[model samples]
Target: MADAPLRSLFQQRFGEAPDLPEILATNPEITRLAARGSCRHFTPDQIDPAILETLCAAALCAPSKSDLQQRDILIVTDPGLLRDLKSLLDAQEWIADAPAMVVFLANNRRQRQLQAWHAQPFPNDHLDAFFNASLDAGIALAFFMIAAEAAGLGCCPISTIRNHLKEVRGLLDLPDHVFPVAGMAVGHPLRAPEISARLPLAKTVHHNQFADITKEEVSAYDTRRLAGADGPGWSEAKAKMYASPQRMDFADVIREIGFKLD
Candidate 1:
């Protein structure tokens, strides 16, 4: 039955099949979630702006932080603006292939506006404010991906948009307390995407008490994820990535843009 397909996908992703309940394993949406993957290749065909409009509307319906609704989306259609953004993210070569692009923003500024409009004291302008806004934006981005994928669209989130935060903020004309969370390259898929392996459930999912991931677990995971690839293992790759001094000023820079982050 279709349940076998879901089990197979779980095996591929986690190297261990799920003992899923039949009803859950058979649900099309649940199966789709298990098989989710990012697509960086796309055809030259363009997507209708209307589809994106509906997707954004649905994505915004996702849960928010304390009903603050501190998130917004920028649908980039202008050729010049898209070109500038592509130039900034050129390192991710496939970004240029996307027929549609969208930038998700964490907009804490709206909450600030609400306080000023009602003549209320804006006391909570510290770390929690920025954290809440960022979470709202992140949740909306996840919702957008799910909605887009359901509509047969492929997308890859580019967090590198934050690497050049100064230039991007300038280009997007983002005011204080509004920050770019990520950019998404969207289009119809040119080919089926391969699922990237993930950590085993034992390594991630735990009981009420938190559990730490052991080195052995990660080593086993690295072997599964790097089976065919000749690249470094996950730990080494991540270590190299973190060695860079890039974006060390991220918190400080955000403070300059109106988040006290105290």
Candidate 2:
């Protein structure tokens, strides 16, 4: 039987968990998928070509902005390239072990070509264009992760792709208008990753009126999360992490890569 907390998670996902009609009350598939979380420890089993193709297909099925399918996925099977990228990304050794790694890109170049071929002026040629492509890419990445999990696979998104943006751009031979939004490493799971604590839904959901946040709400979250097995957790950890603002100069790198986010 699904416990209250687990069932509440399903409910919180879509505004409220609906009671299943008598006939379809329990779905093994959804229950199984909902149980998933990230997986840091992975087995060495290789994913087959057919499955990889299916995963990519599912990813691309994600909604695109204005039907302008401006996203691409680069499947990296090359060991040498992976090692080089690892070195560039501060040598995070865990990255190199994953059997498959893929870079998801925001490809604005295609739209530019469409403009040229159709003899149209690519008028919105400033920051908005870049932002749109990046958003599109991010949506695709999210869909891909959810689809992969639903298919009984485990994944970890590596935003560290930005840490070595220049190197990755060169390695992938990405054109000027194509930027790496994120990378994903996939494999079979050895064990489930830690279930990181989350703030209660009440803390986040806003009703009809824009609710003002109170100190009590914040304190309540801190106390509730810190009380679990993953105790000693506090919002201060997040504050401290962001306080110094490490890895803050990526805009300069973005410009260097020919994106004029003016």
TM-score of 2: 0.85
Question: Model 2, which residues run further than 4 Å from truth?
Answer: 1-33, 90-93, 228-234
Native-referenced Cα lDDT, model 1: 0.91
Q: Which tens-of-lDDT digit does each residue in 157-218 have in candidate 2?
A: 88888877777889989888898999988888777765544555555566786666577766
What are the lDDT figures for the candidates, one per model?
0.91, 0.76
In candidate 1, what are the lDDT values of residues 142-166, reduced to their tens digit?
A: 9999999999999989999999899
Which clashing pairs does model 1 show?
none
Worst 10 residues of 2 by lDDT: 14-23
On TM-score, the leading prediction is: 1
Model 1 TM-score, 2 decimals: 0.97
